[model samples]
Target: MNSLEHLQEKVNYDKIFDCVQCGYCLPACPTYETMERETHSPRGRINLVKMVAEGKASVEDLRDPIEKCLGCMACTTVCPTNVQYGQILEGAKEVIEEHDVKSMAQKKVEAFLFESFFPSSNWMGTLGNATWLYQKSGIQKFVQTTYLTALAPMRLGRFERVLPDLPSPFERAFRKRRVLPDYKLRTTVAFFTGCVMDGIFFKTNQHTVELLRLAGAEVLLPKEQTCCGALHSHSGKGLSAKELAMTNIEAFDLEDVDYIVNNAGGCGAKMTEYPHLFEQGTEWHERAKEFAAKVRDISEVLVELDGLTFTTPVPRTVTYQPSCHMTNVQRVSEPPRMLLNNIPGLKVKELNRPDFCCGSAGIYNLVNYDESMEILDLKMIDVIERKPNAIITTNPGCLLQMKLGVERHGLEGEMEAMHLVDLLMEAEPAAK
Candidate 1:
């Protein structure tokens, strides 16, 4: 007669049992290593879900462990049984969102982010404009110096340190546009300039497109595409993520392009997994599969092009931080390094535990500040030890998190964090 016995449709009961609990994932899991608690590990979370399915545990029992997860998917990389831990985590999240109790503030923030800002580029632009003015007008400086952000709600104070300056003059020029290569185009691609990638990390997107052009590919920024819905899907809003996927499928003219380029690793991973969102054999499902097939990380696309050449000498020590989505989800580990190695005189230092999460698992650092900082500090330990002039990564979230780490460790004078595409563009001779 337990409520958990009547498992909801959202919970994948069978998948929950896939975990053999052999503890293979223990060393690979960041949260488990940090918290040293059984509840925060993959095996523990999978067991909790299975328990809920079997009426041994309640939805409430699953909340803390699931929420604490970085969703880095490092466990999946080592799982011998091929357990789709990411899928299980997503299902568990859906179940939590539906039945778990949430505060009014939590509900409001989710609504604002998923419903209000994430679905539309206009909202992103509007917010981006305000942020631009805040930085430009010196108000941000005044507030930071005056400690006024401490008075703001929702720990906006700590979050403010992570905000990067918005790109000017170039922001409007890059929106929903197309750029043709000056040379004979080897191929054509549609670029997925994501919500956060476009607004906050706008310059990275620009550099991504420029790199694509230099590699001899025609780039398309289709006007009809919307947010990649990575945040929504990661947060358990499956329906919302599906809606955005459908809109994007219709947006890109797949007939005309050879690849759908995604510079942001998180978005690339989600977009490439679009087929899983729809039931097999549905029309939308077929479309999702086709759309997903074309999605490639910008690094992957760049590596595929044979015409790439770097005349500019970067001549700096650099380390690479692989986004969880890029390494684990997208299964892309080498293309960025291969690209980096291509640059003349650039010292590509291998970061110890390159696959570790930088504490910026999407909005993770924002919601779970203390825990996020713990992970970030661990990451910084490796970063400071490596002592690279710059840390390059494939996703916007990682870029911001590493930048924050630089700021937090007072290493602003010593090191910088940048996107892979930005590094490539900088190393391009024409860019000099």
Candidate 2:
């Protein structure tokens, strides 16, 4: 009983009840738009949570609709009444895990892999080095269609959604002069190279560091850090997520860094939630809280830095796609835009329905391909209508999904997709 209670950590319910049902968040709510169901809507989920609190509904009633949610917190951003719905959903997941416990067999398998595979540089490096080989051989399909589905408990999306064609790991890139020199080192930040980002989008991480160094930061790469626990948490293996967080807390605390900045929005969100996974708190709990407090989205850090004067002349309209985790979970629209606008001669045009999810909710694109495609189609149409020269976003998932989507739908080469850091790097320092 104690253990179960510990799992369902206490949440601020009073804040949850403050939602005024204004429906302002509806426009930003992706799941609501996808299903058009009350239960999937933010208001409806809060209602279910209220019922669950009152013992009027079982955890089973809250299972499917809630699980179907992408954990996007766009609803909270638009809510004038100040409902912290994201925190509520994460807390609700804990409660469901404690009481309901459905899908144990599948979750058990995921727990094993996420805990084992993502924690070490060696394991991830080997796997990163193998992705290109797998694609070279005709064995990619069998591994993609059969092995991944069979070995793993769930699907993230279609074949293209989660396919990270990583040639070299981010660790190797960092180890081989992937950074620039910083004179002052105003702040030393540790980058959490998440699984997919570390492997496939290694250049993005490099760009992130370049941007950081340009902003007067000395970036530290903690060689011991793991997956940031987001993969395990999303896969219904909260225990593994907790263990991963503990490992990260220890590794990150090693350096005398000012803050931990993550390019991956999912990792940033998870790092911010580390404290909630604890019971009544000890020294470790305090340590996790301190780390969480220091966690910063890459944009957040870049925007906050002094002398981030941009010299890159975009000279054309650039559409911005905010990741669901960054937009909803982290509530970071202004920082990204602020940084983008800093670039000389750049026009920051908003994507139609900018807050809507791109349907690449972490692994959601891979497992729920049909729904994911539907969402991405909506976004693609919006992007094509704008006719921007480039689409800059933060998350790798968005880059992948948006890239694959535009190509398949024959919008190929019409618009380019890249990370905000990629553009930030183009901003040259004032010439001596």
Candidate 3:
């Protein structure tokens, strides 16, 4: 079958009609703002999908626009007709991946990342250990001093400079699986420690668990939970994404916990939409709905429990760069701000475009480095205007991207980038 046939067969061609070519999504689209092209905007892309389905354009015509999309879903929020753009986007991605021929090396890399690296806890743990060794064994320093990093790809070198210090192998090995509240337990929650969250930003994950415990909850770190499959779903590996979703559903079980809380906005948004990955009326689809309903962002849970009260003051001015998925997909905008506002002396300055994508839609920055940087530069313009001490965000991708933004704009020493949980931990009293 041809690409058009695959798209017709697998893609949600019916939903393409939902987009009415209304111009509301253009202003909200980061790519449209940056690229100044109709082909890059949400309505423009929707039209392209429609054209492909009707045999007016080949699937190849849709490839660049689809691939270049941050998949931030900002347009969906502003749409008057409530267009399900995400489903359409993911459908196009799957059809493209199905038909496009890839070189051997590219195929191998995709196989490794989608099938092996992301889904395995053991592999993620090993990655953490490897990174720790790179940072701690003087190798990083040698590479930096010897200018070896200069020889590497520009994006890799920039990312390397902002890479967070990983917890030592010993620390990761001895990490706690569960923590009980020092005070009376108000509820029970199973924390979704994400693959990247566990491997790279392990300290942030640690802080999340500690904060949840302090908030009067019993936190369970399920052993069987794997990656949330956001990356797989975004990349068009639908089968792999479904497998990971099922693994996570079985891992959390949802029988004992009042909520399945996650700190990463991208992971939370994806987990909450698990029901979309399966066929309606199927057993897995129903099971996915049950699991998705239990998923909650940590900030939402904290607000629900009235758990934020900082005795100690954090005397710093900060601006929030919200995660796109958290804000747009998860429909969580105010909780992080509410948490930030509760800090004693921390001043919150709003960005001009608070809902703008930081251009770190998962691995978009890595794959589309130049385009990502363009979007980040646009985001940093509003951030620079605030002149805050730190740029705070929820997801790890945004955290790193914001850090890179701070570094790229030569604001490194003047401003820092931090995860919201880490900042909140700073405001907690020392004796707690």
Tens-place lDDT per residue, model 1, 230-279, is 88887888999999999999998544899999989899999988999999
lDDT of 3 by residue, 1-432 (tens): 875666676678888878888799999999999889999999999899888888898888887888789999999999999999999999888877887743343345466565657888778889889989999999999988887887764346777888899999899999888889877788999999999889889999999998888888899999899999999888888998999999999988944999999999999999999999999999999999999999999999988877546788999999999998998888999999998988999999999999899998987787678899999998999999999999999998999899999999999789999999999999973223
User: What TM-score quantifies how close candidate 1 is to the native fold?
Assistant: 0.95
lDDT of 2 by residue, 356-408 (tens): 88887766665466677888888888988888877888887788887766665
Greater-TM-score candidate between 1 and 2: 1
Residue pairs with backbone overlap in model 3: none
TM-score for all models, in order of appearance: 0.95, 0.82, 0.95
Deviation from native of the Cα of residue 227 in model 2, angstroms: 1.4
Residue pair clashes in candidate 2? 155-367, 156-365, 156-366, 156-367, 157-365, 157-366, 157-367
Find the candidate with the highest lDDT and give its number.
Answer: 3
Determine which window of 10 residues in candidate 2 has minimal summed lDDT: 3-12
Model 2, position 28: C-alpha lDDT score: 77
